[model samples]
Structure formats: structure tokens, C-alpha cells
Target: MVSRELIARHCICCGGGNLEKSPAVLMPFVALRVFGHEPVEITEDWGLRDLRQGMAYTLCNSLQCQNCGALFLDYRFTDEQMEALYRNYRDELYNEQRIRFEPGYANVPPHYHQRANYLCEVEAWLAPYLPEAPAVLDFGGDSGINSLFREHNQLLHIHDISGVELVPGAERADLERIRQCHYDLVTCSQVLEHVPYPLDFVKQMLPALGTGSLIYVEVPHEALLRAHPGSLQLATCKRHWHEHVNFFTESSMRVLLESLGLVVVDVLHLPVDIGWTQGEVMGLLARQA
Candidate 1:
């Protein structure tokens, strides 16, 4: 295996020039897997490609703006390719095997509890500033399960790329539609990192907010990377290009949001899994100043 350190040194996001064999960081490569050997389609931006697994091939980790500290492995996908991966790809990394639902009772597993805990933390932090059971928009709310917990007082609006029928208020609206409306609170949990452009994504939502409206966002904290070295491998396995492209630290996240004129009200750390690492998991609540 090639050295990750060497890859980092030549990382395009870190490196000064076009992709070259200068350092591993500036230009790194990792073992990648694709399901069913699907069609490798090219994206309009030409930054990504859908690599059909005709044969496993090594490719550059792609260049990112080191100044902004964005490291994306320049891989694009056609809509069909994306659908195939999300629907059919079943592996330890992409395990759809463990169903989180069963029947009448809430299939509330440990993960659900984790989600509940995170939501509770947010509730506490925003309690003094927010109104009782305010309307909330959960960007990328996969199933709207979290909305169930807040059903009593909070009115929930869910937006996601794929329309999930599982949740109650599941909206098939795209991000564009989401940007047009204002809500009392917005919950963007663990979704921003997967976006191709984090800055642009947040900016789109700014016009929709009132002065005191709150935006609650979460991403896999960069500290988690340091806490669990093995996560590097796990990340690659569990849909690297599609799932997450931009990683963030608390400082980075603050800078990104504040630049858009949102005042950072509160920031907290959260773990990906409580059992695995003692890393900092980050949550940020911002409001228009």
C-alpha cells in the first residue's frame, strides 16, 4: 500500500499545482470499490467519473482548494449510477441489511438514541432563544424519523435528494425549493459534507431565514479522523465520493457559515459512534446577525 502521508504531501487540495507525482498528500491514491461494475459516466463538470468496475484502477485523489482545505476525490456520477449505488450496493460498508424499522413500535436502535441525544443537545442549546415548538426544516432528512420526536410542538418540514416514503413530512423538494422558504429553525444533520460545494450550499439557504431564525447543522467532525485512524479505510469503503467529499473542523465550519453573515450562536462536539472513538463530534447553530 502507498503511504497516506506521502499522498497528503502531494494532495491537490494542499499542493500548489496540477496533479503530479510530487507528494502523496498532493496526489494520493487509495483502494476503491464499485458495485456490480456499473457504467462509469462522466459528470458535466468533468471533475468526476462513474468508474464501472470493468477492472479496479488506481486514480489520483483529485485536486482541491488547499486554501479552503477542501479535499474531494474528483469523481462524478450520472443520476443512474447514483441510483444503482444507493439502492443495490450491499456490503459491510454499505449495509442496508440492518433495517432500522420493524412494526408498530419505534425501531429506535442505538443509532436512533444517538440521534435523539444530539437533537436534545440542540434543543437545550436553543431553548432560551427559540420559541416553543417552532417550525423546523430538516435539510436532507432521509426518513423524517427525527421529526417524530419533535411532533408535539415542533412543526417539521423535511427536504431530501431521494424521496423517502418512510417519514411523515417527507418532502420531495430539492435544495433549490428549500432555499425559497423561511422557517423558525433548520436542522441540517450530517449532510453538508456530502455536498460538492459546501459554501454554495449554505449561501442558498441564507435568503430564506429571518433575523432570529436558527440553522442547526452537523457534519462528521474532522477530529473524528484523528481519533480513529482506521476511519480512513472505513470512509473509503462506505461510499467515499458520493457520501462525503468535503470534511470540516469547527473552525472551518464557523468560517464557512460566518462568511455568509450568520452569527455563530453555539458550537458543540459530537461523536460518530459513542463506543468507537473519544473524538469530538461538531454541531453548530447559527442565526442571521
Candidate 2:
């Protein structure tokens, strides 16, 4: 692709404009899988629509927040781009089997852990805080399986753009209702990175949370990945530019939460899998002061 100066994005953490490009770059999504920077050559006729051969169509450049140490993809997708990409994201990259498996590992599906290990920490820390028959809202909680692990008797509602949530008895609430309803706990896991304006999105939902309510957040750690390069081959072998747009560091995440007038209760750096020498994702639990 044509090399240009990486756009300086407003830091969600520090509210700074010092985001700069990183040394690491990977292949574009259409050109390859999440394995490396090289093209994987997809010729399986999975509706090969737009084929362009150049740097502009190939490289997925990474950006770093010079002020906060967080890493993110500098490339921002437009409304049209987001629609075209997500329309077939799960179907192509995952469902149709476009993803590549690493050495010695079977081709395991994504969201390999129905109940993420990090959630265990969140679940434990949340026990003392939850009310009797807690009303839980899992924003972007895919399939609502994670809620099953939290509390059985709890009133659970799942909010997701994808309509594939298969949990029994779980209510599907829209943004309007969720914004008005007061929830005991609001979980936003792996959601911020996909949205164009994460700050504005949170601003919209903040009113739905009542006093003493908990907001549990999880995101991939860019700081850990930068420090541990070898672990990346397993975590993100190829670049996923469309989805994981923003990667947060521990310090950056704390600043982001605190900036929104929420007190940080705890921050946990969790491995991708328990006891494995690999990449990490971060979990943050916070509530209004």
C-alpha cells in the first residue's frame, strides 16, 4: 500500500494526539490469515470480489500511543468499509474456514473458551458486590454462554449486534431499553476495539448503569504483545485490522476508565490460556464513584 504518515488518533486513555506507527506490520485481511505478514493466497473462490496487488492493499500497519504506550491499528474503516467487512467476517474468516491453524494445534474454532479464564477472576471479584437476584447485562456477549457461568438465578440480558445468541431464557435487549434499565452488572468484553468511537459508545450506555453497579471490561493487551513478541505467533499470527482496531495497555486502560468518572476497582493481566507461555488480554472492573 501507499506509505503515508499514520494518522494521530485521540487517545481514549490520555486524550492525547501522539499516536505513531510501530515497526511491526502484517498482511491485510483479504490477502492472508492471522498467521504472519505474508499473503496466504486465497483461491478457493470464496466470492473473491476486490483483488488489488500493491502495498496499500497488503500491509496492516500498527500504531502506538506515544503518550500512553498502547498499540492500535492506525487504519480506520469508513461506514461503508465496516459494513462490507462485517457482513461476511464471521462467515468467511471463521465459518467458511479461511483461518489457518498453528503448528501442533488442531483447527480449533474461535472463542475456544466458552467461559474465558479471565472471567473467572471477574466472577470471583464480583461475588461480594452483586445483589440478590442480580440483573446482569452482557453487552456484546456472544451467544450468552459466559453468563451461564456467572449466576444461574440471576436475571441475564444480552445485547449483541450478531443475532446468534443461543442461550435459553436470556432476553435480547436493544440499546434504547438497555440505556434506560438499571443493571446490577454490565459486562463489555471484547467490544470496544471494533467500534469507531469507543468513548462515545460508552457515553451512551453509562446512564443505564445505576449507583453501585459494576462494569466489567476486557480487551487485548498491546503492551504485553510488544514486550513478548514470540507469544504473538500464537495469539495473532496474522493481522485482524477490521476487528481489533484498538489495543489497550494497563496504564492506558486505567486512564480511560478513570477519565469517564469511574473508579477503578481492579485490573488483571490474563494469559490467553491458563498456564500457557503466550500473549495476554486485560480485564478491568470499575464502577461510578
Candidate 3:
């Protein structure tokens, strides 16, 4: 059974109509043999790799959300299925065997490092007005990287669901315990879109902050919608379907945050120069009052 939150409803982007729901199913793929000359056990669960398999690849027929215009993988995972899938993720595909990244390429930036920079940028911008040594918390502080707070020379206590595997000596945290603590600022970057219930996530995190505290959320700006329909380079990702279900535009983001009684303090457009993925529009949000 699909989790209620993952149930397909309205399109998040254009809000055209109801999304056509489908069942989640798996197919088999040989990643290396099909894409390159190596052996990577690709599975239908991986989505895009199997859909756009190769030169003679056949695209997977999944439902596109009418509102958000996102072609998403069906998210009907039963609790047992989701548990089994993620329970061994690190020990399995990501860690057991070091998958060779394609050669002649720069080491792609780690997701945590990129996220840390975003926190720093927000703090740098908000520091002038905030009191010195203000308390801050990152909702998904992967490795305490954001807590280092380099730009303002301040430290932020973090609360996360898990500890950092890559960074040694990082503190382990539970979301519930962190909520009991007070903070002046809260930052949750690039995490809102992956969640099935963004509104509730924000609602829960908001109370962890004190009065006049700020909350910063960053997510993709529906850049795919802005592309000319006929442009050949318009971005498309099959693998991404499983990960990012909610796509937000500037307007939609404002609507969602503001509806939760958080004032839209500011929106920052992320630099487009770093383009390993689609959509250049990333937003930085601050909650007011």
C-alpha cells in the first residue's frame, strides 16, 4: 500500500488537474552492460536508467502530474517494502562496492558540502540583523557541517534523523529531542521537495524556533516549466522520479510557506553555474513572525 502522503493527488506545478496514479513495480537492468562497458545491476526501482536504457531504449510509461508537470515514479511502497529497500541501502549499493564514477570527470561535489554552503550563505545574509551567537538548528544537519557556521563565526546546534557517515565525530540527534530545544534560526535546504508532506514538515519545525525566529527552506524552482516547449535541451530525468516528487515554483513556494503562517522573508536564487542537474531556480525562504 502506498503511504497516504505519497498518494498521487494534484499536480504540484501547473495545478492542471488530478494526477494519474499507478502501481510501483520493479524491472531488471544491467547498468554497466547497457550504459557503459561495466557491470552495474540496474533495477526498475532505479527508474530512469531502465526507462531510457540505451540507444534503442524504451521509455517507462509513468503518469505525469498535471499540476506540477513532474513525470514521477509510482510511490506505492508498502511499509515493509520501504523498510527493506532503505534498511540496507548504505551497506548495499552505495557502500559495499564502490561504484566507479565515470572517469575524466571532476569529483562531483558531495551533497552535504553543497547543503552546508547554502546554510552559510543564509547566515551571512541574516547575521547583520540577528543577535550575535544566535542559536540555530538545521533540520537535516547531515554531519554538523552547517553547524560549523564559518561565515559568521557562530555555532549552530543541529537536530537530524541520522548522524553523518562521512564525517567522523559528528553528534547523533533525534528530531523529537531537537524540537524540545530552542533556536533562533532553522535551516532545511533541498529537503522539502523530497518529503511527501511538506506543509506538515514545516509546521512541525516552526515551533522549535522562538518568537521572531527564522526558518529557511530551499528547493528547486520549477525551471522545467520555463523552458521553451520546443527546446531540445529541456531537462528530463527518469531516475529522479523516485526522489523528488514535489516541484515548487517561486509562487507556489510562497503560497505554501505563507499559508502555514510563516511570512515570506526572502527568496534567494541559487547560482546557475553549478549544473549537474536540471533547473537553475533554487529558493531560500525565511519565515517571519
TM-score for each candidate, following the candidate numbering: 0.60, 0.73, 0.62
Q: How many clashes does each candidate structure show, in the order listed?
A: 22, 6, 8
Top model by lDDT, which number?
2
Pairs of residues clashing in candidate 3: 11-67, 11-68, 12-68, 13-67, 13-68, 14-67, 15-67, 32-38
Question: Which candidate has the top score in TM-score?
Answer: 2
What TM-score number comes out for model 1? 0.60
Tens-digit lDDT track of model 3 for 11-124: 433333455544332222222222223334556566874364433322232445543345444443344544443343344353322334333223443442454334455556
Query: Which residue runs of candidate 3 sit more than 4 Å off their true CA positions?
Result: 1-6, 11-92, 95-120, 146-155, 165-173, 222-242, 272-281
On residues 26-50, what C-alpha lDDT tens digit does candidate 2 reach at each position?
Answer: 3345333432244455554645578
How much does candidate 2 score in TM-score? 0.73
Off by over 4 Å in 1: 1-56, 62-68, 76-84, 87-117, 147-149, 169-182, 223-242, 272-280
Clashes in model 2: which pairs? 1-55, 1-56, 34-237, 34-238, 35-237, 35-238
Q: Tell me the TM-score of model 3.
A: 0.62
Ranking by lDDT: 2, 1, 3
Task: Rate residue 9 of model 3 by lDDT.
Answer: 46
Candidate 2 stretches with Cα past 4 Å from truth are 1-8, 23-26, 30-57, 92-94, 100-106, 110-113, 148-153, 226-242, 272-279
Worst 10 residues of 1 by lDDT: 21-30
For candidate 1, the per-residue lDDT at 170 reads: 47
Candidate 1 structure lDDT = 0.53
